[model samples]
Target: MDTELGYSIIPLAILGGAIRVSTPFLFVSLGEALTERSGRINLGLEGTLVFGAMSGYAVAYLTNSPWLGVGAAMICGALFGLIHGVICSLPRVNDIAVGIAMMILGMGLAFYFGKPYVQPVAPDLPAIGFGWWSDIPQVRAALEVNVLFLIGAVLAVVLWWMLRSTRIGLILRVVGDSTDAARAMGLRPAVVRTCATAVGGAFAGVGGAYLSLYYPGSWNEGISSGQGLMAVALVIFARWNPLACFGAALLFGGAGALGPVLQSVGISEGYYLFFAAPYVLTLGVLIATSSPTRAMTGAPGELSITK
Candidate 1:
């Protein structure tokens, strides 16, 4: 029961936990980053996330290929995004409310279809071995990262470049900043928003895929616990930057693993508080970053939530 023991193990525990837990957040945050950059918000990403998880697990279990399941989940997610975009485009419907409804629907559908798939095993994802460079056993073990983690890092750089240097990125940013300005430039705001939402949904779907194929590799009612919603908050905390999302996700992942790490060290007090770490951190970040005293900025202008 040495307090120093927990402190000494913090680095290894954080690294391992970050690897195991950040995949879902990475996917969801990236998706939201794209959607928000386009001047629209798909609050229903929560629904899309759970549905994608169920669909990915079920499909992977049936087909014996986790990759295929991930692809299928992306398709399903895009379809959901398309539906959300279309609905939100309507004159009077509130996007936030629609998102809530979609969440209920998505979860319900997941539970209903997932009923037949209780605890089904799916194929697992492959890991990357950067551990060859590490001589220390703990370092090597902690550095045994997933290929998706690399992909997420690459994606962040690519997205940041795209937003800064690409024409399409410029168009999306312009549209998000101002619908009138977009229209003035002969760009279609609705079309941009719709595409953004679809892409975001696809990312959420991949996030779901990660949950079933990599971290847990099975389908159950409790497979995901509010990851989708947390990703939304994460996007804001990341300041809508995909690269920052990667770092934020890793932070969240470490926070998530605290409970298990504590239990591993034979200290189980306040386990539930450790589980709440990610949410609490997220809320703190949001509060610190979002200041009512100053003009709440950085979000696209056409976005309803920001307005």
Candidate 2:
């Protein structure tokens, strides 16, 4: 390879890593963003994510179609969210405690169903190529990107617009800001939260599907490693903005890829440290964004966790 070509490869590799690794974070973060915007925190998303991955992989393995798996995952995720929402809507149930319980339940269900799928070879999702114009071998190689990334980008823009300029978005914001205000305006807080949770769960399910059907085919216990939890932190760090979640997810993705990228470059020292980079970065951002002194300025007023 030419010197300049070799030099340019690093950036390309980083970009590839960002796209590949960020898919899960993007999905989960967006889901969390939606849930938080509706004035609830679904810590159970971790369970939803893992369970969705297992369900998606198993369905794809049995049916030989990745889309079916994705659909199934979404359904399962929505069901999980519905359960969480219904339980949380109860008079005195602590959302956090309920979230933890749901997480355990979701993971258990996933593991039980996932046992038979540990070794199955499943169909993978198709990727969209944007490298048609690139004649250079490295350029072509570097430009191979997933179609979901584009879809996610579009979703972010749509969500931003919806939140800023739509009636439904206004209702969600009002409900999040003040349940009394929502009630005074004839809006049902429980109904809105239920819908939001269900929608967020669907997104999280898609993220899990992406994990099993695209980034890594087949099912296994180790398919995920706290991507869902980190995504919850990411939503807080992004201040519940969909667009900011996208950027933050990309950054987390890059952090996640550091270990493997370092190994590729022949530096394997402190491998575990590389894996911890995303978590550490997330914690740092959370600390900076959350402070009693400043009172988490952009946070929705009705959010229990932030308050």
Candidate 3:
């Protein structure tokens, strides 16, 4: 009976943790999807995530409002994206190089600015309770969902719809699929790409806000845990589709949650090994999806020229 009970709660706990942990992945991947769809890639989102975490935490601490912190982080991230865009727009400039430089700069700025907030406590973002239906205490705690998760879910649907039907989405697709075509249509590829990158960065900022303002719920030196970088791969895995990003994020989140679920169920043996499961899963996904004979399906044509 005890073993049966453990099995039941374990999956529930993992499901809850996946929703919580994947929030950042969902936001960042969606942002990357937008950027990549515009025929540009920003490898420096890791820096953006770090900076956002710092800025969001600081603002929340000072203003007593987590949402304001999210706003500040978004602004900061947009600025970073803007800088990256400007550099990449110059003739003969390498987007990847510009992205790397931007990441370094963002991390440096974040470290300088985030130092003071490390010790201070910030207001936590509010969470939603979906576990009221469950009688078990562990299940209830595990089922506590954050508001951002719901928002992210809605965003996925909205983005999917807009991309398929909106004019702006058409323009982005054209720019990504063919530079000459965009030029023929009198569309400025540079400007469009720049705007896309900025918006993508803003989304990454929200992801960072979720990191510091919710899970772990504090400012620290290592807040992102490479979710920004993971998001890039996630965008590729999702074939640049916004809706696919949400699913990929949940998959990654489930991998991340595996260790804790086992530990919670009194299965501590080799739990440390399970902790690396997320990274392993990422690598495995990349390997399985890799193919030389076929081009990446749904990849933006301009994406190949970034190198």
Candidate 4:
């Protein structure tokens, strides 16, 4: 009976886990894609994500509103991005180094301020039950999707469209491709890059909010587990496309859920090894897509990593 149950539920478990786990990756990758499109890289998004998680949970606990917490997280994330953008805009400043510094700073600040709120109960984000017609508990659980995940999906489509069709998108593409050309065209690369970084930070903050207000649904330092950093690799794997980011995020999420899904069926052997699947997948993606002599296909011309 147990073995039979495992066979029946494994697919369902993976499906549910994929949707539930992909939200943060979706938001962070989208944000990073936008920033990269403008020829700037914000490694500091990890910091923004962690800080946003802490701030969102703290605000939710105090105000008793999860949405408010999300708002606060976005605001805070924007500020973190703004700081990174401004500093990197300075002469001889390395955006990558600044990003790393911001990550450490954000983590330190979150740890210091988040300590008091660690034990508090915060309001969690709501989910829309898509499995209401199902009689099976596992099916229902698998189908109940979070509102933020839906938002991220829609945002992915909208973002992809905007990048391809809007004036702002064109400008970002121009700036990303050549600073000299953007300048000749009367565009300020510094300003554009800075704003892009801030916007990316905002997206990452929302991702952080989802981490605390949904899924794991709690405030903790370890909640991120490097998902924030993994998003950078995810962007590369997606070839800097917002829509692709969504699909890639789901793939990563499914991989992440593989170990636990198998363990749910009493297949505990190599359970810990299963948890490493996402990282291995990340390695595989980087290896497969990366080449020493050529830029990745569809990569922005001005992207620092590509150069």
Q: Can you give the TM-score per candidate against the true fold?
A: 0.91, 0.92, 0.94, 0.95
Give stretches of model 2 more than 4 Å off: 1-8, 135-141, 283-295
User: Backbone collision count in every prediction?
Assistant: 0, 0, 0, 0
Tens-digit lDDT string for candidate 4 (101-169): 999999999999999998989999999999999777788889989999999999999999999999999
Q: Which tens-of-lDDT digit does each residue in 178-200 have in candidate 2?
A: 99999999999999998898888
Query: What tens digits encode model 1's per-residue C-alpha lDDT throughout 242-282?
Result: 88899999999999888887778787898898878877887
Q: What lDDT score belongs to each candidate, Candidate 1 first?
A: 0.84, 0.84, 0.87, 0.91
TM-score of 1: 0.91
- If both were scored by TM-score, which would come out higher, candidate 1 or candidate 4? 4
Candidate 2 lands at a TM-score of 0.92
- After superposition, candidate 1 runs with Cα above 4 Å error: 1-7, 133-140, 287-295
Error of 3 at 7 (Å): 2.2
Give the 10-residue window scoring lowest on summed lDDT in candidate 1: 1-10
> Which candidate has the highest lDDT of all?
4
Ranking by TM-score: 4, 3, 2, 1
TM-score of model 3 relative to the true fold? 0.94
Q: Which scores greater on lDDT, model 2 or model 3?
A: 3
Pairs that clash in candidate 2? none
Candidate RMSDs in order: 2.8, 2.2, 2.1, 1.9
Pitting candidate 1 against candidate 3, the one with the higher TM-score is 3
